[model samples]
Target chain A: MNRKLLLAPAAGLLLCCFGCQDTVNTVENEPQEPVSNIRDVRVVTDKFLRDRLIIRSVRMATAASGNQVAEVAATNARTGVFSQAWSGITGENPYTVAYKFVWMDEAGMAVETNLSAWRTVQIKPGETVFFKSVAPNARCRDFLLNLKESD
Target chain B: MKFRLLLLPAAALAALLSSCATDSHYVDATDTTVAVKNKNRMSSSDWVVITQDAGNALLASPLFEEYLEAYRIDAEAALKEAEAAGEKITTREKLTAMKPLLMLSTIQNNTSEHIDSKLLTERLREILFNSGKVRFTTYAAGEGQSIDAATAQARQLKNDPNIKKRTALKKGTVHAYDLSLAGVIIKQTAQDGRNNEMSYTFNLTLTDNSTGEGVWTYSKEIKRQHKQGALSW
Candidate 1:
């Protein structure tokens, strides 16, 4: 009787783990044209947000007026190894992240632009969002994107 | 009995002091994560967020590219003429002279609450002006509470005998604006038994003064919600 009681709770816990831990699965056709990606250096201060969102890629381009622009794609997936069945479940809480972009001049000093305001966005457990920014002027040659978990 | 009586008064004094405790501190002006005391009203941080988004969008628009192209052509032609005449002119001077002038117009507020439209317009003006891409003239447009009356008053000094003729402003020297910016703010509210929600929409347009056509337009929406507890209204 005791053995059966122990197995009952064990099976219950396993089912809860499998049902509650939901993940996202995505698919799309491969790109037809070539694309360029910029290598990025990151400084992580918030491990909680870092665990929830993954930076997929960073793309850079120049506008017609000589301003630099950047686009970042990030997915809300925790770092882990899970079974394929995790993707089929749908019972996870969404996470809200606040991020900002600070532009730097060619002299490597931070540019004083009003564009560097923290903006918040909510992402579901398995969704992706893109953050984009344009340099205040052509003199801005580099940028840093800061992200933190929203209160 | 004496010791117990003294303890009772000390404890009472502690309780009274604790009840009157106050909390006040400074926060970074740029920090946007601060909690909203009232969800219905927009906070200063909301103004910051909206201003940056809308201002950046306008700067990145294709119309701004056209504006800069025009300035480039003008600057180049002016430089060639100066060279032909054996005159010297700096790049900064040429840019300032050739850059387009923009005027701020009225931003109508269509919300239940009394919102100062300057919260939006002034911030937008500051960002666009500091970008080094455009300049603003004291010459105002339709219904935008103008600060230009001071300039006009100063010009009237030309008539005053005390003012030197050369020190007073010239009558025909005022530059007309090349572009104007105008916008509107609207809000929607909802309540479902316990939670109160509000959504604000901001729309802005940049119009070419010479062509009388909108060169760029942008719209942004922000939503906020608050839940009432058992003791709250």
Candidate 2:
């Protein structure tokens, strides 16, 4: 039997390549928490959002999360979910929002901008958000994107 | 060459363990626009005390010298009992004919912050309007008169069917000489149903003008959960 059907598709492609390398080393060795309630913090202006301008938010429940259920403990921000494609917006939005992120080093240059650092966000009143630039300085691998117009 | 000196001490111990490795990310800090540390909340002032100036409101507080030394020792013991009864009274007319005072204070949210109960009631109405001896009002500072345009401009200056008319409707005290300062802000939370070992109370009782009946009572109890890590305990 064709050598046991090519060794049963070579043992199902070697167990799908070691089960995708054991799920990327168990998600880079789990455990990660520290980022505060950046609400509906939007800004995705998709359309392939050149220079990457599609960052969305969801995760803001603390007063020590007790009995959880802030819409079921929505800590959203494990990044990785993008289907892209959308267009819609109009009225009652005079404009007033702020965000700016940039930091890169690791021979990639660009850093030095932390005037006693900060980053808090929230936005909801007809949502349609997006955000960009994450790599919040872990010796920053690279990132940059800013948006202004809030007073 | 012993394998290029063992590959230069394994590339200098892999560049000294990748320059003391450390690269993991995720930081929100309750992102209320991230200035971190309990988003926003750090007021100096954002007041409001107009309930028809609650009897010359002011005495907002730094214990306005403890209510001006308890209203100058209750107007020097009611002017030595009106000068031993000879009665020629007038320590500012016996502190404006006493019987209108109610003092109290305790608005502690001692910043580890979750403030903005209107910035601790606008710094307790600027310390009870610089404590001129309690006569404050600040239910969000509103009451510049308008219960139907002040009884329709006091009924057009007591009526005027062309300057002169009778009692087609003229009564009195439709809400006059009113005042209010109300109380409470004490906070210590274990989350709603409360009790994570106790310390959570948020009870605000605002008042201004006609909601009257509030001679003064302030309270505080913000012990934002025995902090830790940023350190405190």
Candidate 3:
């Protein structure tokens, strides 16, 4: 009887862990020509966070006003729920993240502007979210994106 | 002795609670640490998001690019007309005069909470001005009058030796606003059992003052829900 009781709880726990994992499925048309202006960069800090928030690619294009525009595609790589045992409350994978963009001039110096602000975006497991920003003026030729977990 | 022992424990508990009290800390206004607390009222974080979103939308719109182009065209035409009329208007003057002036009309706050919509308007004005595409005229009539009177006074004193070195002030040179911006913020609330949800909708419109027609319009909605006792303030 003791063995059966132990097995029952063990099986229930296993089921909970496996069944709670969430993932997304996607379908797209045939691959088109790759964009030439897309840059490849390194991500070096916070391996756990870097894994959860995966940066897929960064692309740049010219806007109508002759200013540079950038788009970042990031995916949520988390797979399961992060639950609090005491409160019996569950949170979905890929928690809310806040992001901001800084514009840079031709000399790679940051362009100072007050219009930029941190914006919040939520992503689901395995889902990709695109963040787009435009340079503050024609002087800006490059950009940087900063991301952090929302408190 | 038993009563005294019980009191001792109670006093110790109170001391512990006092020691555990939270201390004040500073957080950046743009940081995510600021979150919505009251469902019925707008928070500073909400203001940041709304202003950012509005600025982004306005900047990305084709209308904004067209507006800048139209200013250049208007300046060139004005210079040509002045030259034809035998008035001496320099290219530098025309270049400096191409900034399109915009006026803040009204922001209707239809919510129960007392919100200073001027904050949003000011943020918008800052963004538009920083973009180098537009300028803002004072919303106060009294302020406008004062500025006009000051400009006239400065023009009268232009020939004074003390003021001769200063830039010449001119009357009737103030660009009248070609565009006006107005908006309304509406709050709606709904309750379902222990869950209360609040939605705030901000609707903004940019209109051509001469034509009295809207050139660009945008609406942003922010929704927050609170389950009673789920969060501690």
Best by lDDT: 1
What residue pairs are clashing in model 3? none
TM-score of 3: 0.79
Q: What TM-score does model 1 achieve against the real structure?
A: 0.81
Please, what is the TM-score per model? 0.81, 0.22, 0.79
Query: Which number leads on TM-score?
Result: 1
- Per residue, candidate 2 scores C-alpha lDDT tens digits across B185-218 of 3333453332232333434333323344333333
lDDT of 1 by residue, B1-233 (tens): 99999999999999999999997888766667763535678788778788888977877788767866775687579778987999866566565766778888878888877787777777777777777767888766656445667767878998899999999986765667877888888998999989889888999988878788887889999888888897975
What is candidate 2's CA lDDT for residue B57?
Answer: 22
lDDT of 2 by residue, A2-61 (tens): 999999998886665444321111123443763334443345453332222224333422
* Two-way lDDT contest, 1 vs 3, winner: 1
The weakest ten consecutive residues by lDDT in model 1 chain B span B29-38
TM-score: the better of candidates 2 and 3: 3
Could you tell me the lDDT of residue A84 within candidate 1?
22
Q: Which candidate order results from sorting by TM-score in descending order?
A: 1, 3, 2
Give the runs in model 1 whose Cα sits over 4 Å from its true position. A1-24, A31-36, A79-92, B1-21, B35-37, B67-95
Off by over 4 Å in 2: A1-80, A83-120, A123-151, B1-119, B123-177, B186-202, B208-233
